[model samples]
Target: MSDPILRLSGVFTDIAQYHILQGVDFEVPRGQVTMLLGRNGVGKTTTLRTIMGHWRARAGQIVLDGQDIAGLPTPAISRMGVGYVPENMGIFSDLTIEENMILAASSGPIDRARLDWLFSVFPPLQTFWKGQAGNLSGGQKQMLSIARAMVEERRLYLIDEPTKGLAPAIVSTMAGALRQLKDQGASILLVEQNFSVARALGDSAVVMDDGRVVWAGAMAELANDASLQERLMGLSMEAGH
Candidate 1:
């Protein structure tokens, strides 16, 4: 197999006096989805932020492809083919949908073909092209966020909780969008709370606890064994999806 597109080795990030990410280590394989799972406050978001340089790595190396990007600025990391969709969606509420997308294009102008493809995946974007992003529903905003990331051709993407607080129907739609992204051979590192989404999209998974990975394996192995899911995630299949 080819080397991982992104590798985090003993990554440590500090926020103020608190040490948020303590020695996080994982690999995002090329052309595969790697799920990052854990309870709240387990540094999952911090890991993604660290990779995007939102939070600087106080220690450890963040290797992208064959280059170390540990301390590079967020823009620098983004220019190197890594895209990040933050938890907040990060869309400018005041901007129109078209304006938001135009700003997201880091590589010259947005490709007309790619824009058309995105419209196919998310038709609402076209419908609301002139409307302010803040006027969009939560699900539409989520789609816009992911779409903005896709606007540029990126090698790897770090997405934080795309399904959080979404209705079941919206979740299903987001799932389909993610499946299309995967089918197109995009590499993704996702931090999701929904096990169903994780299992459906992940090729491999790493579970973090208190800023460290406690479990790492195939998503199928974790999905098939309810006992393992309970032991690691502290939730039964019946409790929630």
Candidate 2:
């Protein structure tokens, strides 16, 4: 396998004197989806924030495409081909959808083909191109957030809980869009609480426990091991919850 597009080695993040991430280590391979899964308060979101430089790491290295990015500012880290979609879906509520996209467009020529592809994948975005982002539903806002990230053609995306708080139909839509992005050769590091969504999109799974990777392997192995799910994810595969 090729070297990872993003790598976190022995990463430790501290908020004042309190430590959030302790020796977190993981890798996101190119053109693949790596799902980070764990229960709430297990440092999943913090890991993403740390990677994006929102939460600075006090120890270890954050390498993007083999270059250290640990000390870089958030904007500089983003410019190094890491796009982030936080759990809040960070849409510019007051701006029109088109305006939001325009703002996110990097300092390069707009990729019309990519824009058209995104529109095709997210049809609602096309219909609401002129609508204010605040007016869109939860799922539409998530689509816009992902679209905003795609506008700059980043090499890797850190998406936090893309399916959270969405209708089942909308979750399906978002899943389809992610699949399309993967097909188009984008590497993704996804944080998801929903096992079904993770199982569907993830090529590999990293199970976090108390800010550390406790398990890492193919998603299929995770799907087949009910005991592991019960122990690591606090989930039971008993037909229907």
Candidate 3:
């Protein structure tokens, strides 16, 4: 209802000659989770990349807090208060957990209070604080990636497929952490495939099909409408259970 923290209007992305996003329009409300859902290969990931300036938009405007960010470089965008967590978790294999955190640390005195809060939210991070990131399990890697993002206190986060290959138990843990982040007033645009996980984390849903947004509404509405889920998400309500 109010001005969104991130707004994508008529966003069109082209990878060389191939167009990925076609006239995609969506708004990510501040301090709320917005789930981006679609069948595989529908450009959900591309949308996240485009937003982060990894892939420049050939047309459209990406506005963040009333400023145009579409034309900015990726590093510029990151400095503009956006954090990104890629699907691979983006943990440096050779670096220790602390080293990875230091890499994401912006040019300022470390916020001990935020670090303590992050460690409190993720205890494993405290235990493996000295361990190499590659040595940590998949779930732990995810926690580190998220913690790295938190260290900077960004205004918005673009998380891409965070639960893609995680175990069921780990997925549950990640979902819980996401809920905690949302409760803490983090504006998140989550690219997710697991319907249950998305339902648990999201306040709103934006369903994309063939690189275009076909549905946008409250998550509960899409969760309850089995027909819409089946038609747009190719998911059966029975399958979710």
Q: Which candidate has the top score in TM-score? A: 1
Model 2, 1-241: lDDT tens digits are: 5798988899999988888899998888898999998888889999999989899899999989889999899999887788899999888999999998988886766688988998998898899999999999878999999889888778899999998888889888889988988887889999987678888889998999898989988887887788988999798533322
Which candidate achieves the best lDDT against the true structure? 1
lDDT (Cα) of model 2: 0.87
Where does candidate 2 clash, by residue pair?
none
| Regions of model 3 farther than 4 Å from truth | none
* lDDT of each residue in 1-241, candidate 3, tens digit only: 6989999999999998888999999999999999999999999999999988889899999999999999789999899889999887888989998889988987676589888888887889989889888998878899899888888788999999888888898788778878888988999999988888988889999999998999999999998889999999779645763
If scored against the real structure, what TM-score would every candidate get? 0.97, 0.95, 0.96
Better of 1 and 2 by TM-score: 1
What is the RMSD, in Å, between candidate 3 and the native fold over all Cα?
Answer: 1.4
RMSD in angstroms between candidate 2 and the native structure over all alpha carbons: 1.5
TM-score for candidate 3, please give it. Answer: 0.96
What's the residue-level lDDT of 66 in candidate 1?
A: 91
Worst 10 residues of 3 by lDDT: 232-241
Off by over 4 Å in 2: 237-241
Residue 23 of model 1: what lDDT? 94
lDDT of each: 0.91, 0.87, 0.89
